[model samples]
Target: MTLTLTDETPPKGFERLVRAEDPASGLRALICIHSTALGPAAGGCRMWNYARWDDARHDVQRLAEGMTYKNAMADLGLGGGKSVILGDAKRDKTPELFRAFGRAINALNGSYYTAEDVGTSPADIAQAATETPYAVGLEGGQYGSGDPSPFTAEGVFQCLRVGAKHVFGSEDLTGRQVLVQGLGHVGMSLAEKLHAAGAALIVTDIDQAALDRAARGLGATVIAPDQVFATQMDIFAPCALGAVLNDTTGPQLTAKLICGAANNQLAHPGIAGALHARGIRYLPDYVVNAGGIISVAGEIHKAGPGYRRDRLAGIAGRVDAMLTRAEQEDRNTTEIAADMVKEILASANRNVA
Candidate 1:
């Protein structure tokens, strides 16, 4: 089925949505540009075997909007955009396909910059860069930032400390029990950080190899993937796909704090309020996960690695300030973070006007 722009209303503040198909390469992709008020839109390109075209569209829309907020909050001088290519990552990737996708990005003329997201990698961005200069996160290049997963994990680790301090009255993770879902690159890196800090880890992943590796390498205990929410732990860190904190899992959550690297962790907007009502101090995903984009933006702008590392190191302080404000105002952290983004956007709009 061909993806079409229908009469249905677009997400509240999206600037543009492009659905494209390349018959030769069998590429079905959606690119969403949420805002360019601050600067050109920038986001990673995710490839997944979406169950439906609408699912891919929805993911792109939500993720792109989140990038807008993320970049704004990070003061990156970048707007928000995202691209999704529909396919099984393990089987469908081809040089021709990504090259074609690169052409599509180039056609945007820098309005949208693509990097690696879930099921995509820095190497894949390198492949795409063979055709477009806008591709980033490539390895070993002058401006290449390489894989950003480790940096992302570092930011999340810092945010976890901030949450610990706010909720448990200490910034230490020592002796804390953390349940980490999805042992992917970011998850594994985060697990290592937590383990090094003397945190007890309960981890789960769909891939047995990854699960075993985490268990053996990090001394983490293994749990069934579906049983994560029911497990008693101080922190539930979702490093996997989005929407894990949905209707089904919300009520079963045993964690006092929810902080992770997953974008759009809430299945619905209401999940934030629900978590808040349960006294779960939810760290906004974008706020915690902005490290990757911050690194990518710095690389693209020729900022040194030291500069990027400095910024990533500051994520905890930024998150702590937001969390403090949320507590003082008696508001959900998600709301507080969104208001911060909105204020930045408003300021940008005023400057442009």
Candidate 2:
């Protein structure tokens, strides 16, 4: 089947959405650039076996916009962009496929820079680098940041500390209960951090191997994936796919706080209000999961070696400030964060003009 771009209305606020196909490698890709107010757009390249072309487009659009907020709030001086390749990560990835994708990125002339996310890895990015220098997160490159997962996990962990402080009057995680959904690289890394901090963990994953490893290595209690939302815990850290906190799961959450590395966590904008109505404090996903982009941006901008460490260290304070502002202004965190991004973007645009 020929994958074609949908004829639906273009995503609001997006500057460009480029769809490409490589017949030779059977590759179909969508690159969405949400903004360039700060600078060139930068985000991850996700590879997944999307069931439909429209699904891939929607995912790319949401993710790209989230990156805009994430970058602006993180003060990265970068715009937002994302690329999605519709294919299975393990079975369909090929050197030719990434090269074709890289060529597509290069065609943008630095309007978008690609890195690793979801189903893509550093090795896959290295393959894309063969065709275009627009890729980051490759191993052994002069300025590459090998894997951003650890950094991202650290950011989430720090945000969890902030949430703990706000909701429980303490940042200490000792003896706290945390249910971490998804044991992928970022999730597993976060589990290790939380465990080391003396937090009891209840973990779940679609991959049995990953789940087993978390149980054995991290001493996490393994639970069925379907049981995550209903589980009682102090914190619910969703490191999995987007839209996990929809109508079905929102009302079922028993956790006091929600903070994680997943992008577009809310099924829709109103879900934020729904979560707030239930007295669950939500640390905005984009603000908490910004470590990956911060790491890659450091390398791209030739920031010092300690840039990632320093930036990650500041996340807790940033989250706290945003939370405090939300409380003082009587608004949900989503609105507070969106306003912050808007101010930054407006200021940048004014300076550019």
Candidate 3:
């Protein structure tokens, strides 16, 4: 009946990791606040059925840390944090469960804010907000940013176009062979955009219905999940999970460019270099996937109309600029992006001092 929350020891760089459990609503959640150096941490609430408790913690830590870089890259005045509920998104979600989770978030005292993510929805966020004012992304009310998936898809679409220019010698995607790996809300929106741009889509997903929809609506060629890495395509978009571009998959990829909305696409530190050595241009995921966060941030800061539009428009410029700089420096784009994020953080610190 009562929510039980315990403060866990975070990893080296993390600020706090809180584990929350509530038998009343069957809620088991972890909220990680990686940093608040910029401002209150802002990120989404993901409800996934992780195989192991360790996996859930790792995912939250990686995602929260990725947000620190992502927010800085987007030029937002906020820090990074993330929360995850361990369960089946489809079968386990309940309004009381989300309210329990919301109480856990409120326990942080505004150090973090939450919205819809991977297995969560705007409707779920509305439930959470009933117990905490920090819940965001509800399109139904004032200052709510609504669903951020379309905005996220837009940002990644910009990266896709800009990356295409450098790799294919043209910005147009007409007839381009693109493999979209994942058909979730953001992934499906991205596929439609690419189909509109005339891209020949090769789609894969665990859900057969989603695959069928893509095939029926967009005329996409459905592929098995096992062949995702080995496929020869112009571009490979990973919209599902992180670390798909690891040592093994990176070498197997025949795609010219890698661009997607998934966070922490790189499995480890050196994977980017290997992709670069193979002459494959890797667009940094965080540098481009900040649209959803920017939308939520507008609500957090309560900026008036057009703020989301203006910020979303800047994603294209950042993607193009990063590409140009990477070419000029002959360095991997991830390194260049990290340096740029560091500069932004340092500048913020200096202004405070």
Candidate 4:
């Protein structure tokens, strides 16, 4: 296993970036620490089959920075960092790779902590934890937070409820048309929640089994992935990858309210404005999808029992407050949420100075 720290100039607000490789295990990964303002940098390690090394680096940087704002806005009192392992998750997962990545994390001391993100699981985290104690989201431990997807789904569901109340004048989701684009673990969980709330579900995903499962179990109407943007629906929950609401898709969306568990949903800041221009209540992804991080943070802080539950429930209240603030200021929810995070980060920096 070989670990390398980058000599390239770190991005603005980034503290460090490092790479790790192991030919024997076919491990190739990069980790970025975006901040240590509130506390130790904490985020998830995502595995992907990126087209290039630069693509992975760019993803890690954006994800790490997003985590900084996410943790801040969620009031988790933790800093932000993220890591990415470039490979096909299904084909390349190995205990050896995660262990090697664990060593890379150990090199950072406790300045950063990692949990499971896209293409990763508690099993992977457990493998990494064997090499270092810096990893969270493990199973069978005192502070273990396990899989964060369900927690994440719960947060999104609650926020979606409040958003529905704001837009539809009622929290009731009964008979509401909802499109769930992506049926991953988190997406499926959110779909189930919405279905239980009596929302008519339209689902799409790359996995046929996932689509079929939702069709059979949740009675969700499966739509082709290409048809997602054009679908007319009351709510569009993008639980898939980031940047789905870019320049093109923003105009195609027919949903009045948007909420989901995906991180960094907006491709750019201006997309938020575009959604607002269309009168869409685009709830900030960081604020509504913070349950997973809040759960992992419980493990990082070694919290007592019930900490995760209480913290997860608080996300709904934050969404409520953010919506009200946005209305009062005549600004988009993304802007309002970003300002809230900036204020917290600035206060932490002031105290540090």
Pairs with backbone N, CA or C atoms under 3 Å apart (clashes), candidate 3: none
The C-alpha stretches of model 4 lying farther than 4 A from their native spots are 1-8, 21-27, 49-53, 86-93
Candidates in order have lDDT scores of 0.86, 0.87, 0.89, 0.89
TM-score of 4: 0.90
Clashing pairs in 2: none
lDDT of 2 by residue, 166-207 (tens): 999999998899999998889999999999999999999999
Listed in order, each prediction's TM-score against the native is 0.89, 0.88, 0.87, 0.90
Better of 2 and 3 by TM-score: 2
Number of the top lDDT candidate: 3
Per-residue lDDT, model 3, residue 70, is: 85
lDDT of 4 by residue, 67-173 (tens): 99889877787999999999999999989888888888888889999988889988898899888999998886688887778988988999999999999999999
Tens digit of per-residue lDDT, candidate 1, span 1-353: 22232223457788888877778888788889999999999999999999998999889997898789888877778899999999999999998888878877877788988999878877777788987888987888687788788888988998999999999999888889999998888999999999999999999999999988988898899999878877899999999998898999998998999889987899998999888888899999888888889889887788887877777766677788888998899888888888878888999999999
Scanning candidate 2 in windows of ten residues, the lowest lDDT window is 1-10
